[model samples]
Target: MNDYLKNGLFLAAGVAIGALGAVALGKGKFSIRPAMADLLSHGMDLKEKTATVLERAKENLDDLMAEAKHAKESREGKSVAEGETA
Candidate 1:
């Protein structure tokens, strides 16, 4: 109930949780990298983000079209496009 006791408990809980999290991330594919990755990824954006997203969108659409072509070629049933050459 004392203010000092509450503060001590809070500090202790923070330390314990931090220690546990550090240990958990110590060895894994999800382990935290250096601050550079976070700074570069989370900071800035605005104009850069829009262009980056649009570029990725174009790439994704190209990939999707390639997949569709592969699927169309693989189909064994009646030709869906009729006269379209393989």
Candidate 2:
């Protein structure tokens, strides 16, 4: 009888601890509502910042390509002049 009682008490404590853990980890509805809201807000802000950075990168890439083309044309002209003199 005493052994049975001890077993019952241990089982009950285990169940209570498990319940508390589940609640703390947001397993139940309404448990993690505030955390979810914060995550969504931060995600939105991150997306906006990422888009802005992408736009700036695109503009910089275009400028670099134009500069490269200009440099290539100048080099070609110099080569042609050298060939004519030789």
- CA lDDT of each candidate? 0.79, 0.92
In candidate 2, what are the lDDT values of residues 1-83, reduced to their tens digit? 69999999999999998798687776564567787689889999999999999999999999999999999999999999999
Decoy 1 TM-score against native: 0.35
Give the deviation of candidate 1 from the true structure as CA RMSD.
Answer: 16.2
The runs of at least 3 residues in candidate 1 whose Cα sits more than 4 Å from the true structure, single-residue gaps closed, are: 1-45, 76-86
| Candidate 2 stretches greater than 4 Å from native | 1-26
RMSD (Å) per prediction? 16.2, 15.7
Considering every candidate listed, which one attains the maximal lDDT? 2
Residue pairs with clashing backbones, model 1: none
Residue pairs whose backbone atoms clash in candidate 2: none
